[model samples]
Target: MSNREGEGKLIQVKGLIKKYGKLTAVNGVNFTVNKGEIFGLLGPNGAGKTTTIEMLVGLRKPDEGSATLGGYDVVTDVGKMKEVMGVQLQATSLFELLTVEELIEMYGSFYKKQVDIEHLIESMMLLEKKSDRVKNLSGGQKQRLAIALALVHDPDVVFLDEPTTGLDPQARRVLWDIILKLKEDGKTIVLTTHYMDEAHVLCDRIAIIDQGEIIALDTPEKLVKLLHSDNAIEFRVIEGELNWNELPNVTKVTKKSNYIYIYSSNLQETLSHLLFICKEKSIIFQDLHIRAATLEDVFISLTGRRLREE
Candidate 1:
């Protein structure tokens, strides 16, 4: 349950805040990302995700608090930090006139050291489009190129902002594979994403931010455990509608159209009550699934709203 775990804090944020005139973008927030782990910043739109990232990368300055990467201040030592970190902003644009290989070389020139272009291109599956113009490439190909540019310097830390936003399922899977490859090479990644499945599959730890504040932070498994819900039984009833207010041991009951979901800490006791009620007033059910709780359910409990809801 420690917010700061692991040795050697690779990235640290303390009392970070950003404001525009009277409106606050990111209130006081603090967290540290360890080396060689995929850290996820998950939140809905307008949750200050972009602002936080921009401040961390030095694109914008924070009005309060400070952030450091590997003991170097992001603002004061911006040049030093920039050399060791690579960033891919959301909806990043590539030079349409530059060929894929040319664009990668351009990015490589920005750093003191250079990476082998042929090797990087091959690793990113961009060998086939090496000679193609940026504008002519498909969305998936453009995404690969963006990732290639981010990794051209073989940086110690990589920051990605929703790299798979508009991609199809197949394209998303491809990007997922690339992310895993980077992790296997022991690169630390910091990403902001709205896709729950993406975070669940790729992130070792996630911080759920909302309204300019971090509401929850933990490994996906640990966050799900916060619900403390076990042996959940989901079903639909036909004969008689059960009143939620009267259900004992039921901590939360939510309904969407005809589907009802009940979360209980005491599953056996709650089920006993449910069966007793059904016996009294005959009810038929379908699609009954008894399973363990998940991070999705945990988010619902924390926010009382869906993650996709704006």
Candidate 2:
């Protein structure tokens, strides 16, 4: 599904702030979500992604600033806001004794209008486990069920916080597909995750938050392009280390253990110079690998830290 013309903004946040005593969790952050677009809050733990989501979803009132969803103020029109939004937090608690279908029905009953239970089950890929007890489901299945509950009311906007956090590779991919389907169905999705690849693949635009502030906001490709280096070369030396900064066309160099990472805008020049230097110095590099710069590299370049580190 696509956003209709003239219906641009679905969610608007301006100077939103949330403080816990002296420590501010969200500090004067501002952004807008276009209708039917997948917007992401990409940050590490304690970066205030959850805090911002809570404030926008009306679970917690912002200490300062304001926000609106679907033309209704989050603070003043919370009752109406709740009716149109669905939220699946990082940790969701469900009755362990309830069957999957029963749990979906229970959540659906809370709304005046509900979607069909079977459709929700099939859409979430939980048909085989529909009659299974909540406790008997796999980690991915449980997460899917939680999302199904959130969509039971056929909400226009969905807020998912780290929806695939603890799942394995297969499960993570499954959830990715489901999220894409939601976007195809024209649901505006707000996702918060530390996984760079997830944000790169799923988000139409991403806001990179760190230490309670938005440091960068753009499409994933544009964000990566901001680094000015499209290629990354990584390798480990057998004995001694060389200063990679002297290399031609190399933009940045970072070293961890015996391994070195070089970012370059011109891949051919950087690789040719590096090969010449290695041969001249008789240095043997091991485990050499080269690939395109990614969202993780962009984050590190901006913050001087990894996404999962701090």
Identify the candidate with maximal lDDT: 2
The estimated TM-scores of all candidates read 0.86, 0.92
In candidate 1, list every pair of residues with a backbone clash. none
Candidate 1: where is the Cα deviation over 4 Å? 1-7, 230-260, 264-292
lDDT tens digits, residues 1-310, model 2? Answer: 1333225788889999999999999999999999899999999999999999999999899999999888778899899878888999987898999999999999999999999999999999999999999999999999999999999999999999999999999999999999999999989999999999999999999999999999999999999888788899988899655767668988888666576778998999899999888988788899999999999888777877778972
Encode model 1's per-residue lDDT on 38-71: one tens digit a residue.
Answer: 9999988888888999999899999999999866
Runs of candidate 2 exceeding 4 Å displacement: 1-7, 236-245, 254-259, 279-287
Span of ten consecutive residues with least summed lDDT in model 1: 1-10
